[model samples]
Structure formats: structure tokens, C-alpha cells
Target: MEISTCTEKMVQIIANSTLEKSLKKTLKEVGVSGYTLFDVRGDGDSGDQSGHLEGDSNILMMVVVPLKTSQNLMEALNGYLKKGHHLMVFSVDAEVLTPSKFG
Candidate 1:
């Protein structure tokens, strides 16, 4: 058995649920192979949306991939965010248990 550290990039995206479809489309256009989206609640400059249901709340999306792909997504998201969409993106180095899955 052998194990080795692999460099991986993971981007966390928290945005309004109203951008769900558009976000997914952006992910595809940015060439993200895999990602996870979840409903979330939190407070920010936009106020609290926990009380309302559906669109009022937020969605959490996580995409893991190579650095190149991550940069592509971030670049696209940068312009999209400037349009006044409530989107926050952050990235971190990830340890992939199954490296082949990401490739």
C-alpha cells in the first residue's frame, strides 16, 4: 500500500438560491467536473434569510478540482459577482482520498 499527498483546489460558493440554475451553468462553462450544492442559512450584509423559505435562503456549492480549473471558475464568478449578485467564493487546498475521481 502507498499513499501520497496530492495538490487539490476546492472552491466554496455561497450565494442566493435564485442563482441556482445560473450558477450550475457557470460551473459547467467553467469546466468543473464535480460539485455539491446544499441549502444553508447565515447572516451577512444582506440581512438574514433564515425565516423565509426557498429563494429567501441561500445555497452552498463546493467544487473540487485542479488549480487551473479553479482559477477559471473564480474568474467567471468575479465578473458575475460585480453584477450585484449575493455570491461569496473562497478556495482552499484539499486532500483528495481518491485522486482519480477528480481527474
Candidate 2:
């Protein structure tokens, strides 16, 4: 059983709603339906405030998927992220305790 994990963060953007929709679409396209999201606030790599000064919101999302589905989802998100979207993405190997959770 192969597993993959992904962590993504978006900064200074009101793209939560759009991001959620895009994520869902990508997940469905890749046959994945499970994910988790959290609200986050922090400074960026340049030591700039992450929207705190401008009263914006930041969100972090994590997704775990079977290896077979990970590539496809990544491909879909790549284009979305390239459109000047302020975001970061990283992936790692993972093990799922509850296999049924993905279903």
C-alpha cells in the first residue's frame, strides 16, 4: 500500500473559497475525497507580516492520498499555483492508520 502526504499554504489571499473549490475539483478528478484544512497566521520568508497588517486571512491545507492518486492531483494544482497565486506546496511519504478513512 503506497501513501502520500501533501501540505500547502496560501498567503495574503482571499482565495480560500476558490482554493477549496479548486482543491475539491482536483481531488475529484484524481478520485480523492479526503482532506483537512486549518487557519494559519505567520510571517513570510521575507519577514513580512502575513496579512496581519492588512487584515487578511491565511489558510493551510493538508491532504493524504494513495500514491496512485497523488500525481494527478499534483498536476492539477501545479497550474493553479502558477497563476501568480501566493502559495507553497510540499509532499512526503505517509502511512494511514484507518484505511477506510480515505473511502
Candidate 3:
């Protein structure tokens, strides 16, 4: 048996839940093939997001994409931050199996 794998980037964005619809639209426009969004709670400059209220909560959006696509995605996300949207975005190197699935 053989295992096939490739390197990519796992981009993670933590932002206000109120931006879910807009964020999803951005992801699609940025050409992200797939992603995962989770209701999450955390403390930050904006204080604690308890996840008890949809509008006041936070969401963690994660996506694994090819290196080139990652750059485009980052640029799109940065646009949100520039607009003063409450968002935290970062990316880490990832070793992904079946990389085409992420492309």
C-alpha cells in the first residue's frame, strides 16, 4: 500500500458570528473548496464570547487549501480586518492527504 500526501496551508479565522453569511460568501468568492465553521467561545480584546447568543458569539472557520490559493484567501480575509471587522486570521503549514480534495 502507498500513501499519497502533499503540503498545504490550514487557514483559521476566528470572527464574530454575526459575520457568518458574509464570511461564507467571501470564502466562496475566494475559491475555497471546502471549510469547517464551529461555534466557539473565547476571550479577546472584545471580551468573552460566551457562545450563548448567536449574534454575540464567535465562530472558527478553518480551511485547507493549496499554497497559491492560500495567499488569495489571506488577501480576501485581510480585507475584512481592514474594514474593522472583528476577525483574527492565521495560517499554518499542513501536510494533507489527498490534497486534490482541498484544491
Candidate 4:
């Protein structure tokens, strides 16, 4: 059995419908059918916001898959990130206690 995990951070202009669409397309291309996304707020070198930056939001997506699938996902994401779009991708070792949950 093989296991792996990857996380991708994407920043989309506020109210941009294409963000979700792009994510779905990328996920499908990478062979990752399942993922979870959460809304997040933060301050970076760019500046600080009193509360949620205006016209900007962050989406964090996490996917856990078998080693082979994870590699494919990362390759697809590389092209996206190279466009200089506001995004980040990272991966690390992971262990799934219940394999059925991923299936």
C-alpha cells in the first residue's frame, strides 16, 4: 500500500466564479476526486486587514491519495502555479488509518 498527501492554496479575486471551476478542472486532471476547502483570513507582507481583506479571500484545499495519484496532481498544479497566479502548493508524508474513508 502507498499513501501521500498534498495541500494547495489558491487566492481568487473576490466573487470570481472561475476559481471554483478552475479548481474542479485541476482536481479532475490530477485524478483527485475528493477534497475539502475552507475559508481563511490572514495578514501577509502585502498588508493587514481589519477583518477579512476586502475583495480578496483564501481557499485551502487538502487531498490525500495514493502515491501515484498525488504525483499526478502535483504536476498539474505546477503549470497553474507557474502562471504567477496567487497560489501555493505543498506536500508531506501522511498516513491514513481508515483506507475506506479515502475510497
Q: Candidate 4 — which residues are off by over 4 angstroms?
A: 1-18, 45-55, 100-103
lDDT of 4 by residue, 1-103 (tens): 7556343322222212236568777887767767777665566643442334544665567777766776777777767668756555677656555452335
Residue 21, candidate 4: alpha-carbon lDDT: 68
Evaluation by TM-score, superior candidate among 1 and 4: 1
- Local accuracy of candidate 2 as per-residue lDDT tens digits, 34-54: 667776666665344355554
**Rank list by TM-score:** 3, 1, 4, 2
Q: Which ten residues in a row have the lowest lDDT in candidate 1?
A: 94-103
Return whichever of 1 and 3 wins on TM-score. 3
The local distance difference test score of each candidate is 0.86, 0.57, 0.88, 0.57
User: What C-alpha RMSD separates each model from the true structure?
Assistant: 1.7, 6.5, 1.5, 6.3
lDDT of 3: 0.88
Per lDDT, the best of the predicted structures is: 3
Off by over 4 Å in 1: 100-103
> Which residue pairs clash within candidate 2?
none
Model 1: lDDT equals 0.86
Model 1 C-alpha lDDT per residue in residues 38-98, reported as the tens digit of each score: 9889888888979387677899999888888899999999987789787889999998776
lDDT of 3 by residue, 1-103 (tens): 9898888899999999989999899989878878998999988799989988767799999999888888998999889889989788889999888675645
TM-score of each: 0.89, 0.64, 0.91, 0.67
